[model samples]
Target: MYENSTELAENKLLLLHIIKSVTIPISNTQLTDIVLENSFVNYFTLQQYITELINTDFLKYVEVNKKKSLQLTQKGENVLMLFKDRISPSKLNQIDEYIHTKIESLKKEFSITADYLPANKDSFIVNLKAIENDTLLLDLKVNVVSKKQAVDLCTKWKHNSADIYNKILNALINE
Candidate 1:
């Protein structure tokens, strides 16, 4: 029973450590994926730990880019730094490795974005973006006559934003 409690404590600390190491606000879903993907804890237990952290003011919800994200509170940082030795060095190394492997994909996922919204009875607005480090590389809104067109545009924009941006830039500069 003591061992189990210790494991739970470690898991909670592991979570706080990850949030700190991420260096940016992350969504709850993203945090869940990171913890679960690393096999650090089960979803239900993670949820419980997160709730406790929030209640204790160790973590809080914040708005970033108009989307909800999780951030570690100042108290959480103090607590983690104080108790971080509870986690082993090898385990810390493992966490570093796993995050390094996943961080690039996570960065790319956020850097390229596309979505569609209704603009009228028969038309849709496709909002596409290529953002890097909070700087908007491209911000485009296209009005299409049908939902299908909007979706297709959004999909293409997501997959080919870089190439599209390059071509458009070249066309404007070279024309």
Candidate 2:
């Protein structure tokens, strides 16, 4: 177990590191194995760390065939991103609320209209329509230059007004 003052921060980092490094869901035994092999941390201490991570909503536990697995939640992902960005708590909370509002507003304003049109001789065009108060309509179109380039682009959209951009990107990729 860690000292009370640093336990939360330490466990949060450990969980984020584990999740970011592993592509597959990790079992407790696997976590212990990695910790023992790579770090000076002990099994019991690591277990305590994992428990704290779960309690703090950073990690989620799943049971498969009587084996337990851990994965990061969206909140956990946000935590990791905040750590990467070195964002202050006040700035992080502000960004979080901003993103939330944008998403909700975009979802309410837009609808997919058409998809998978030939952008060129060998490309695709995705179309979307914005509905204002369920009455007025505005159309937008996005061109995908290649099959490989048609992957979801909305996942990368971020800004104060990124919601509309993400909505259009999502409609394109899904279409």
Candidate 3:
């Protein structure tokens, strides 16, 4: 069994709470209300945390009624399952399959070769190659991205795209 640090555990718990309280396509106003009602976390912190979550792909924006609202991704759902003690080997396998299929589709789309291999019991590595141009390595600890889109990103941003790629790569590594 993996044991998490106190701070990490607490932050995960807080994220779970936020995910649960908000509806699909939740507005900032609704998220603020949830933060105000459920936890002692301040509004600014809650907003900051939500933005971070979105950047990390745990949360995504949904367009509803011409408004952008937040919804949890599969990654967020998995995190919540972890918090609820409902994460099992079978569940993990299902998630893995889903992620793999997504990656395959992306690879086909971007004309890139990708290898999604288990790094450890808890994480996976997605190493991508762009047909001798550049290698874009994404170390995904918890979330998944499309391989083809990743390669396309590399192709589109190959020249003078290091800064943006570096920022994204840094975020993935830090997470």
Candidate 4:
């Protein structure tokens, strides 16, 4: 039983460490995939640990680019630094390696954002952004009279952001 508890503690630390080591905030899905791939913890238990960390103010869940993402708080970083030795050096290296491999794809995942809000009773305002390495390449807002148009714009933005960017740039340069 003592060993099990120790393992749980290590898992929590591991989770925090992984979050800190990454360049961008991670979604729950990304966290789950990495944890399950590297650790012995199951999905439900992993979620429980995440909740406990959030409740304790060690981790904060926030919407980044309109998607739920996990970020390590300063308290979490300090705690990890204090107990990080309990996790082996080799394990740390493995975590770093895994994140390094996935870094580019993860950046791409969060590089675009789309959201809508009610502007008034009759219209909705859609916000769209395209980002690269923390730089905002495009920020657009459109007002439409119907929610369906707002939704469709968001969907199309997600699918064709690159093409849209090129066309806009080409128009500006040619004009």
Candidate 5:
């Protein structure tokens, strides 16, 4: 029983280390994903741990661009710093490798943005963009008569950007 409790404590310390290692605040989904992917904790258990951390003031929640994310509190950082040795070097390396491989894709997923603006009482303009490495690769704006159309276009652009971009380049090059 003592051994099991010790392992649980170690897992919580490991989680704190993972949360502290990231430079930017990460969404709860992202955090849970990394833990789940590494087989460190089950989903329900992770949720419980997250609740416990928040209750203990080790982790605080914030909203960035209307999305919720988790940031390590000062107490959380201090706790991790003091207990970091509870995590094995091999496990730390695994966490590092998983994050390095996934961070770029996560950034790209957020880079494609879409929005709509009221052009007039009867018309709206939908603007969509795709950015790579901080460079704007595509910016398309279309005027539509209805807000629904504008919103639909924006949703379609986000989902079909690669295909649409390829088609546009192909048509232009052949012309």
Candidate 6:
């Protein structure tokens, strides 16, 4: 159990309010960036608050697109509704403004995903995707004979997914 200090409680509630406002599961990295960019809390303290929220069932982890992300539980929503006034109005407005400014780009960033899995003793399968607004722009599965090759493909796709996507589209569309 952690200390019930006022700052701690407010920060925890702030996090819950942000997650609830998003109305969708969000990656920890995105959440951290939003909170820390605004100087809402330090990284260590933010992490601690998250852990406490999860432990208390105020938040939970869920997998979206095979990515682990944080979500507000119903209990979290209820709690925030009950005591969200603890968050200063200025801080609340800042969070909302920052999220609005960045949510679409953040979603687009997370939508491009790459991963690999073993297909058999000697081969690996790489899955690459570029998605936007819940639409699949590109989805490619490549089979390679070695793990290194699969890893390279995944890495390259992540680094140059837009370029690769454009090239593919051009190749298919042009004579």
Task: Please report, in order, the local distance difference test score of every candidate based on alpha carbons.
Answer: 0.85, 0.56, 0.52, 0.87, 0.81, 0.88
Error of 3 at 103 (Å): 36
> Residue 117 in model 5: shift from native, Å?
11
Model 3: lowest-lDDT 10 consecutive positions = 132-141
- Model 3: per-residue Cα lDDT over 75-141, one tens digit each: 8777776674433345344434543444433233333333455555554555443331224343222
TM-score for each of the candidates: 0.89, 0.42, 0.40, 0.76, 0.69, 0.80
What candidate 1 gets wrong by more than 4 Å, as runs, is 1-3
> Where does the lowest 10-residue lDDT sum fall in candidate 1?
1-10
Question: lDDT per residue, candidate 6, 94-134, as tens digits?
Answer: 98898888876777668889999999999999999998777
Q: Which scores better on TM-score, 2 or 6?
A: 6
lDDT of 4 by residue, 1-175 (tens): 2367777788899999989887697899989988888874789988998999999999999987668899999999999989999887888898999999988767766887788999999999999899987788989899999999999999988888889889978998897
Model 3: how far is 26 from its true place, Å? 1.4
How does candidate 2 score on lDDT? 0.56
Q: Give the better candidate number (3 or 6) by lDDT.
A: 6
Predicted candidate 5 versus true structure: per-residue lDDT over 40-152, tens digit per residue: 87898888888888999888899754558788899998888888888888999999888788886666456677899999999998987887765788888889999999989
lDDT assessment of candidate 5: 0.81
* Pairs in steric clash, model 1: none
Model 6: how far residue 22 lies from native, Å: 3.1
Q: Total backbone clashes of model 6?
A: 0
Lowest summed lDDT window (length 10), candidate 5: 104-113
**Shift of residue 42 alpha carbon in model 6, Å:** 2.0
How well is each residue in 96-116 modelled by candidate 1, as lDDT tens digits?
888888887777666777888
- Predicted structure with the largest lDDT when compared to the true one: 6
Q: Candidate 1, 154: how far from true, in Å?
A: 2.4
